[model samples]
Structure formats: C-alpha cells, structure tokens
Target: MTKSLIDILDLSTGEIDELIETANRIIENPQAYAHKCEGKKLATLFFEPSTRTRLSFEAAMYELGGHVLGFSEAASSSASKGESVSDTVRVVSGYADIIAMRHPKEGAPMVASMKSLVPVINAGDGGHNHPTQTLTDLLTIRRKMGRLDHLTVGLCGDLKFGRTVHSLIGALSRYEGIRFVLISPQELTIPDYIREEVLEDGHQDYVETTDLEAVMPELDILYMTRVQRERFFNEADYIRLKDSYILTREKLDSAKKDMCILHPLPRVNEISVDVDEDSRAGYFDQALYGKYIRMALILKLLGVE
Candidate 1:
C-alpha cells in the first residue's frame, strides 16, 4: 500500500510519535543519518508562495544527501500553462522519489496524491491543512515541555483561517488532558465544525476568547499566528484585526516562566520583536525543528527510515 500524509490524522498517534523520535535521533546523531536518502529526489510543487515550509523541505532533503527538483511558484511551472494537478503529479511522481506540495486550492494535494505514484506530503493546502507544520508544532511542544499531554495550549490570533492552529488542535485533541484556549477576534474564532466536531466529539476541554492577556497567565504553550492579509476578503477587516493580539514583553510577564511560545513563521508583527529575546520564545527553535522533522518525514516517505 502507498502512504501519503495529506492530513495530520493520516498518521496514527504511534506513527507521529515515531516520527518525532526519529527527528530527535537525527538531531542528536546527524552523522549516522547523513546519507539516509542519498540517491532519492524530492519534488516541491509549491503553487503558493512560501518561505519556511518550502525552504525547510529543500534543506531537509539536502541534509539527508538527497536532491530536490521543482518550481517555487505555479507561474514558473507547467501549471501556468494549464496543466492539471493530477497531470503534474503524475509526471513528477516518475522523477522524484517523494513529493511535498503546497497549493492555494483546498485539497489540491489530495487530488495530486490520488494520481501520484510516490508519497505526497501536504505542505499546505489553501487554509485547510498543513500536516507537516502540525508535526513541527508537536515536536517543539514535546521537546520543550517534555510532554504532549497535560498542557493548556493557547492558540492566539486568526484561528478561523489559520491552518496550523486547526491542524494542531486536531492533533492535540487525541492526547489526554489537552485543553485549548482559543484566543482570537469573535469573527476569527475557530470554525464551528472544528469546535463542534473535533473538540466536542472528543469531549475535550476548550475556551474561546478575544482577550490575549486574560489567557496569557493560564497557558502552558502559546501558539501565535499572523492575521493573514491574504486570507481576509475585505481589506478593512484585515486592517482592523491584524493587531488584535500582539505578544509583547509585558504580556509575557504574566505567563509561566517555563511556558513556551511558538509561531509558524514569516510572522508580521503578531509577536513583538522584544519577545524574541525571552528564553520562553521557541518559534525560532521551532523553525529549526521543522527541518529535522521534515528530514524524518522524507526518510519515512521514501522508505529510508
């Protein structure tokens, strides 16, 4: 059977843990895994612009002594010439041992996976899912906090359209004693389906609030997200809500000294630069972990792990 990671739920809990364990081992023993995927190739079919995820995938493959090939944007690929995702993946599958794709349309990678012969990992699909980012978040929390369970995770800013938050929430809901403090503008609160279906169905505990300061004191981990101007249909709404939850040094004074702060990057001021100097700031470290976890992912998908 072929395996693809289009959603966080595509991997079982055990599989996710195994990936994290492999990632950690790779981090600690880089020399042993240097040639893990030496002869393989990864195709990064990114239809949308990406900084962190795209570069991280390339870096991961390179670190594993593998090669990477593909276009950074749809305009640079045959997609711009009207090639369908299925056609593109069908063709690329023959060239690369594995594929990590990001597309502006929701479920575009899923569509590619159906036609692809090799494993397809979803880098991001519209604002629908980014399983690899979720993996990075989970690994960061596990490595920093020493446990994935028994933590109050506060998801701040743009929850409604934040794919990382949605995927993280879904992944964390499977763990015991995981509480969610969803902090966002009322209009940007988690979608009803996620709140009702994922959280409620699992009988997990959660709270929704517009106030970041109110929840700062109670969080074990704070996952911040940018108010994406691209996600907003109205320019006025984007302008009004972009600064709704900036994390400042003053705000961190109320948080636990051991609390970890994480963000899926290319951040635009949701987190104040002053907060970067804090020991609790784990976003930069989280970005590093993104590469290690991705290396593990590529190795796994290519049957190298």
Candidate 2:
C-alpha cells in the first residue's frame, strides 16, 4: 500500500497538517535530520524546462543527505528517442528509491505511477496540478498567517491555465470560510468546471471579476500568477489586459496591512519589482519554504527517521 501524490486531493487534511509541521521542524533544525536519507536516491524526471522546480527538488534531496539522478529536460532523456512515459518510469524505478516527475501532458505521471515500483510525485502535469507546490503553498500560508480556515484568498491572473492556482484552490476547498476572488480578464477567467465544481457546489463563497483593485481590500492572501502572452488567441488582447493586472504600489495603499502577497515564481510583470520591499511580500520566502517542504517530503518518502 504505497501512497502516491498524484493530486492535491490525494492527502487527507490531517496528513497535510502533519507535512506542514514536519517541514517547520526541518526548517528550524536542518542538522537534526542531516542523515535522514543518507542511503536513499531521488529521480527527478522533468519532461519540461523548469529551472526553479528542478533545482529545488535536487537541493531538497541533497540537503537530506540523499543522492539525486535524472534528466531536467525531455530532450536530454530517452523521450528524445521516443520512449514512453511508462517505460521511462520503469527504468528509473530500478535505479532510484523515489521519483519526482514533471511532464507537459496532463495525466502522464499518473500513467507512469501505474508501472512504477516507487512513489511517484507529480511535479507539474501539463496545465493541470502540482501537488508538491500546493503543499509548499499550504506550508507558507499556514506559517505566515497562522490559519488556513476563514481566510479570503484572492487568486489573480492566468486562472484559465495557472496550474498552481488550480491546485491551491482544490486543497483550500477542504478548509472553512475560504471565499475566493478569481480576478482575471474575461478571456482568462477561471474555467467552468472549477467554478461549478469547487466554488458553487463546494459551497464556498466566491466571486469573479476583472477588476483587481476592486477586490484587493477583501483578500487575506493575494496569490498572483503570470499572465503569459502564449495563452491569448490574439496578441493585441494580451497587450490590452497585461498592465491592468500588474500589482503596483498604488494598488497596495488600499489593501489591508496584514494581507500577504504570493507568487509562484518566474514572474513577469504581474507583480511590480517595487513590491519586493513590502513586509507582506512572501514570494521570496515562499521559494525558501519550497525547499524546506521538499526536504521534509524526501525524508518522509525515503522512510528515514
């Protein structure tokens, strides 16, 4: 009965809490678990280019005293020779004790997990979900604000294709009083399934709007995502909407002092660089928390005390 983290929903609420606690403990005393995974190995099978995610995973394994092996890009691996995901997983499983994979196709890692002998972590599957990132987000939110429940979380920009927002919303839905403000252009509004399935039927109080500043005062957590030019059907439309969503200092003047700003990296102009000096800006800290959470996950999966 091996558990695989294929989605954010794979872990129970209690399990999520435990992981957060473990991550905090590891963060406070890194040397305490220095040899936790001394004899273990982690394989990062990235089928896409992700400098941040790949480096964080490898750094996590290394910090836990574990060895790492894998291809960071699809073209560098057997996939370039036309090997199937299942075949790749089967081969990697024989070499590594656990696998963290990222693929551009939705459900590719799930298919790999079926044939894998070790636990398969979905790093980021297409425009789908990234469970590990969701975990990192949970850890960050809990540590920063001290509660996950009863918070007004605003998800802004690229909702139609932001995998982090999709995954975070799924995980947050299990909590209480989580009112969501989905802010994006008409073209980039949240998908219907998410709105209907998670917001409406899940009975969470939520609203959709294109005006970012109009909803800023109500948000406890402002989660920002990049509005990529590639998502638009027309270039002119992207140019028209890009600056409206960008978070400027003027917009934060009306926001609550305690409201925290978060972004899942490689940010374009969605967040202004000037906001980095704000005390509530947690994106950089979020990246550090990502490494800590990854270290905790590696230790847990490797069965190291």
Q: Write the per-residue lDDT of candidate 2 for residues 6-117, one digit (tens) a residue.
A: 9989889998898889999998898987878888899999999898899999999988888999998999999999999989999999999999999999999899889999
Q: Count the backbone clashes (under 3 Å) in each candidate.
A: 0, 0
Using alpha carbons, what is the TM-score of model 2? 0.97
- Global lDDT scores for all candidate models: 0.92, 0.90
lDDT of 1: 0.92
Off by over 4 Å in 2: none
- Give one digit per residue, the lDDT tens place, for model 1 in 30-87: 9899888889999999998898899999999999999999989999999999999999
- Looking at candidate 1, the ten consecutive residues that score lowest on lDDT are 225-234
Q: Give the distance in Å from residue 13's predicted Cα in candidate 2 to where it truly belongs.
A: 0.8
Using lDDT as the measure, which candidate wins?
1
